[model samples]
Target: MGVDAARGLSVIGMTMVHVGPNSAEGLGGAIYGFPHGRASVLFVLVAGIGAALLSRTDERRWDARLRLFWIAALFLLIGLGLQSLDHGVAVILQHYTAFYLLALLLIPASPSLLFGLGIATALVGPIAYFVLRRLLSDVVERETVGWGDGLGDVLAGLVLTGPYPVLVWGAIVIWGMWIGRQKLTYASVQWILIASGIVVAISAEAISWLALGQYGRPDDSTDWRNLLIADGHSQMPLWLISSIGSATALVGIGLAIGRRWPSAIWPLAALGQVALTYYIAHLVALHFLEDRLRFSDVRHAAPSAMMLAVLGIGFAIAWRRYLRRGPVEWIMARPFDRHRRREASQNPRP
Candidate 1:
């Protein structure tokens, strides 16, 4: 329920970032902009946690791992098909698939190793990404992920230049795996996570402010100094630190809320459980509504975002009363279910 609650928040956050007053001035901007980048970060982190939980089995691990790879392939195909629609949104499913694949390597690692790798990546990955961008400046042809985009462009976007670079963003997923391994049912763990998150977030922000204050924020985006700013989507080390901290805090809060008042978060839990279905559904909605609405303008976008969120929550709640799995989720699980049944048939209990 806690994981679902956090996932629900991430889903809502994505909606706000996609269709709300993200760049509007004053309170609206502050409200809407809060989810920018962080929502996706949280979403990916939740995925990692889910992966960890999925692989927690005493049976042969290969089957579970194989299932994950299959799902990744599924995501890649669906993401590509969605991108072909040329919807105004940058589809993240492809990048999400990439994360799933990378996580396979660390799924069996110890919690300490996972934590160490996550921290190391958080510190070093951004620098390497920036360096590679400079090195590949003239090599890889930059293009957005969309239909008709060259294969090379799509691959590059998934790994490096896209809005969510796996190199740096992968750290969040690794940290999430670490968190997932912990005894989350304990109040001590939850409070510790909350404290750690608060400390990391504040420290990163404070350092960023001091560094940018002394060196000054650069107007030229190419300036190395820009890396000191911890704005969302900046893809800088500081931003990664801050976002990871924020994601950790969110998960902790969700867990606390869920354990304390499951009833209060029931609607969100329902929405979260069917997040994948809603994610694609909302994009489909946007595709159709694009002609009627100007999502670029916050005035129209904000209300539309709220309306979609309300509808999604209501639909999810209503759907849960009758169905356990969502439409898309059920489809995704079919192959695995069949595989398990086949194994059971072939190797019946002795």
Candidate 2:
């Protein structure tokens, strides 16, 4: 159920990011926010949640993890190809693919260890970013190459620009895993999450104000790379606060709803059941509508509304038709199942 809600939220976030503000208009833009960067953050955090949940399931075998890694890699390749063809070189999927691989490796660790590592990574991530920025800034200045040079440069650029968010995101994943291992109905856990979320959100906002007052507007184009570093007091803090706050709020809301009306879980569950499929489907649909059809303007309204309606109705229908898996879910599961069969054949005693 929680997974379902997370999936639905991810779709919402994706829609906002792809649709952009100009197209969305007043209410739509307000609901999503300008730049809509936070939506992707939410999607990544929920991804952590889903990964944690999967780690707890019986399907958490080596072959299963490898297959998932390959899937992420495939997406990463697609993202890279798309960037090379359409946009320049600022694609995100390569980083996502790297993060996915890292998550797969870390997912099997004990929750306590994972949580401790998450905390350590969060604390160190910014500092690492700062140091890397100094080094990379030199390279960029010396070479006089714009950030979007070659694919290699872009990949390197991501090491400094990209790793920080993934570090924080990895922590969120660990936190989700810890939550997954817990007794779900505990009131104290809920209170703690809510309180922590509020405090973090407030702190982030306050810091952002301070930074803006001292350094200038958050979007000031002094050096685009500085935004990724901690010294700038812009992107890092804002991202941390917003992502953590939104993720916690989501968990709190899900728990509250789960307790209040159990049957309300259906739609979210249906969405979650086919999360990977829907995620890929969204990319494909967005590409088709905006790129192939050349109806980028229509994307402002039609795509989002159509996606929402389709997902809602499709989820309802899917729930009735299939008891456990979504269409994509069933497809992805096959490779893992085959691997399991091979393992079973080798070790028949178990």
Candidate 3:
């Protein structure tokens, strides 16, 4: 159930990210900003919570860890394959897999240790990056390589090109795991997270404004530095802090709102349940639309709205009727089947 919620948030975020601007001026634009980024963070945090939950289920911790390692490898391979087709190296699932592999070793530690690690990563990772960038900016620019060159370069780029977000993201996961272990219900956590979220959200935004700057009203061909340094779009440092703060608030709000009217968000949740499917599907669909259908000339607003509506409706319908796991998720779950079967068979020993 928690996994479903996380997946739902991911799908919604991916859709908005891919679609860019939409027709509706107010709601759609806001979704594209802090909300979209926050959704991605929530997805990662919940992933940590799910991982911790899974670790507690059985005694074969080594086998479980191996399974996760392979799954991460698979995601990395998929990302490589997609990049080969010139799809760009922003494949987040690959990053998730990589983080999960790293987190597996840390999963067994005490909550305080995990939390401490989270705080350390969140604080220290960016400082290290800034220092490295100051020293290596010229060299890094001189190399000037894309991620698709090879596995080693891709791995290296993954580490060097923006490891801070992943570090903070991993921290969120650890934090979620710590939260998940508690004996609170969804409702109770919602209120607590909401109140805390607001405080964090304000702090994050303030830090973002101080570190970066505010958006200078939307326009075509906005300056790259402005975008990079702007409140919602900045990277590392301010980006990590602000996004985390906003994400905390949003998750709290989502849970609170979800409790009040579950049905209102049933569609969003449904879309989330089949997130991997929807994510890959969106990429493929966009490729076809732009490359084959020749919609490359179309404006961002109309096409984005159309695609968002189509994806939302399609996923909601699929979730309402389907009983099986999403195709990609099912493929990812294959490593667990052997253990599940062994457990099942052991339960009724002959």
Candidate 4:
């Protein structure tokens, strides 16, 4: 329930980042900026935690691995298909598949090892990306949104240069896997995570501010000095660290809140449970409304986002009353489980 609530918040935050009012003045700026990079980080981290939970539940290793493979394949196909729509937003499902594949290799690893690898990725991925970007400047010139262009371009994009490069973003997922393995229901653990996350987030931001202030931001976007700043979507080490910390803290807070007052967060938890459906639905809505919304205008931003949330949350709650899983989730689950589906159908949810 805590995880679902946290994931719900992540979805909502991401929606705000996409449609909220963008003003550099007053509370609107802070509201618009708060979830910029952090929402995606939380989203990815939650995915890892979910994978870990799945692995823990299944008794047969082969069965779990097969399910993960199916999921990855589905994501890859769907992501590629979505890219063809030219929806404007950089779809992350392809990169998400990369993380799912990576998880297969690390699922059997010890929690400590997982944590170590996550930390190493946090430290090294950005630097490696920087070096690779410099070296392969000509080959990977564009953002490389989809594989329709070429295999090399898409591979480079998914691994290093895309909006959510698996190399750097994988750390959050790995750490999330570690978090899932922990005894998260424990109050002590929750508090520790909250405190440590706040400390780490603050320290990372402070260091980034000091470094950037002292050296000054360079005109060149590719300058190494740019890496020192912790701006959202910059994909720098500091940003990664800060995002991880903030995400951890948010998850911890969600866990605490859910434990304390489960009923209070029912809507959020319901929304989280069907997050994939909401994500896809929102994207489709955005695509249709793209011209009319005029995303650049502040007037439609907040209203659009509010409408999305209301519709999404309402749909999730209504759907959950009749079905155990989301529509997409149900399709993903039963496509490979004919026997399970038969038994479930016979028994019925109620």
Candidate 5:
């Protein structure tokens, strides 16, 4: 339930970042900056936890991991297809697919191992990328996100140049899996998450303040790479800490909500169950706006985003009320279901 709630929150955050205004003057500015890279971080973090949970269940059967690989491939394909829509948004799902594949390799690791690796990656990934970018012969810097770009360029976008680089972003997922192994339903665990999040977020900002003030580091200059790392440049150590801590805090809040307002959480829970459905639906809505309504300006896109998101959740609740799973989820799982059934028949449990 907490997982679902966190997922729902990420979806909403991502939508706002995509469709809301872009300025630093008023409410729009606040809303625009809220999700920046954090929403995608949370989304993938939840995915890591989900993968861990799935692996646990798969302990009873052998084919689950194989199915996971197929699912990852499908997501990669779907994400690339969404990019073909050319919605002017840097979608995370493309990189998300690659992270899933990378995460799968570590899914069976113990919780301690997951946490250790996550921390190591968060600390070292940026430096490694910094060096590798130079060593990769500036290949990543020249690349741009587009359907026409070469496959090599696209791979670089997923790995190094994109806003959500898999190397750093995937560490959040690993940490999330570690958290998922914890006693999430406990109030003590929730408090730790909340406290850690607030502390780390504040610390990151304080560091940035010092960098820009006492040290006289210009925020615009890329020379001091860590200056604006908190919420903008996600490849930095502080940015990963701030964002993953935010995600941890969100999951904790979800747990609290599940305990306190069981009824109120149902709608978002429903939306979370069908997160992929709504994810794809939003891009389709954007495509429709492009093709039919001819809405060219993002300044006024908030209403459309709100309408589509509301409609998507509303339909999800209505559909889930009668059906077991969302349409796309059902479609994705059917093949695995059939295989499981056939395997069960072939080796009858005596």
Candidate 6:
């Protein structure tokens, strides 16, 4: 439930980043700036935690793969459909599908092993990204979103680049599994999550500052090599580290929200419960009803964001009162084996 709340918050953060003009100025800018990469990372990391939890259940092993594949297909297919809408948003469900496919082999591993591998990936993967992208410059530049873009580009986008590159993003999932293995309900564990998160995030940014200097900009010589320390430049080692820290912080804070403020948490948690439904609908709304919703412009997006937040909160609370799952979720699970679809065997509303 707490994780659900966390996911809801993460999606809300994404809403701000997507709608706003990437502000770097005032209160609106602050909202847009802080959650840009941070929220997306948290979303993926929470997904990892959710997957780990599902794998720990007694359900048939094949059932998990079947369910994941089905979900992945749905996300990819729908994401392509959303792309046709041309709402100017870079949809992430395509990358998420790739992540799920990757997780099939990973869901069974021990938490310690996952955490260790996550650390290793963080250390090595970004350097690999820089080297690989430059080596495969032409292939890397090809469009991976639309069909007929060629298989090489699609694979690269999934494994090496994009809105969320799976190689580095996979590490977040791995660490999330480690987090899932812990007794998150325990206050001590929660605080430890907060503590370790801060250490890693700060370390990444500090290293970046030391290497690049406060005002140093990305140059031809430094851009590729400096990935070792560059923050805000997605897929870099430093950025990955800091994002992991922020993701963990969100998990800790989410649990705290669940434990302390049940009343306030209810609406957000409800929204979390229907996340896929809301997420997809958000894009649809932004596409067809952008003007009606009055968030068509990035410069004036905060108001629309606020409005959608309130509406989603209220709608989720109301909808969940009557149905256990959102429409999209229920549809996704309908084809699964009956036993696997049981509430006990399912992943939470990710």
Best by TM-score: 1
TM-score versus the correct structure, for each prediction: 0.93, 0.73, 0.78, 0.92, 0.88, 0.89
lDDT by residue for model 3 (263-282), tens: 77666666666676777766
> Tens digits of per-residue lDDT for model 4 on 1-350?
88898899898878877665434455766776688889889999888888887787547556667778888888877777777664576777777888888887777878899889989999998788777767776653437466575777667777777888888888888999998888889998888888989999999999999998999985665688968988887778999999999999988988888889989888999999999889887777777777654365445676777788889999999999999889888878886578667868899987
lDDT of each: 0.82, 0.56, 0.58, 0.82, 0.73, 0.76
Give, for candidate 5, the lowest lDDT window spanning 10 residues. Answer: 290-299
In candidate 6, which residue ranges exceed 4 Å CA deviation? 58-60, 142-144, 220-222, 228-233, 291-299, 337-350
Worst 10 residues of 3 by lDDT: 221-230
lDDT of 2 by residue, 1-350 (tens): 65466556656555545554423455654554532544455556666666666667656656548765876766565555555443222345555665666668876677788768766765566555545555665542212123356777654543445432454455555565566665556767666666776777567667766766777653432444444333212335355555656666666566656667757865665665566566655556555555432233443455564565377548645664755666656665667778879989999993
lDDT at 314 for candidate 3? Answer: 72
CA displacement after TM-score superposition, residue 305 of candidate 1 (Å): 1.4
RMSD after CA superposition, every candidate: 2.1, 5.4, 5.1, 3.0, 3.0, 4.2
Error of 3 at 108 (Å): 0.6
What's the true lDDT of residue 249 in model 1? 88
Better of 1 and 3 by TM-score: 1
Angstrom error at residue 299, model 5: 8.5
Error of 3 at 346 (Å): 3.6
Candidates sorted on lDDT, descending: 1, 4, 6, 5, 3, 2
Candidate that would win on lDDT:
1
Total backbone collisions, model 4: 0
Give lDDT tens digits, candidate 6, residues 189-274. Answer: 88888888888888877888776765465665225555755445367788888998978987887787778877877787898889
Ranked by TM-score, the better of candidates 1 and 6 is 1
lDDT score for residue 129 of model 2: 52
Winner on lDDT (4 vs 6)? 4
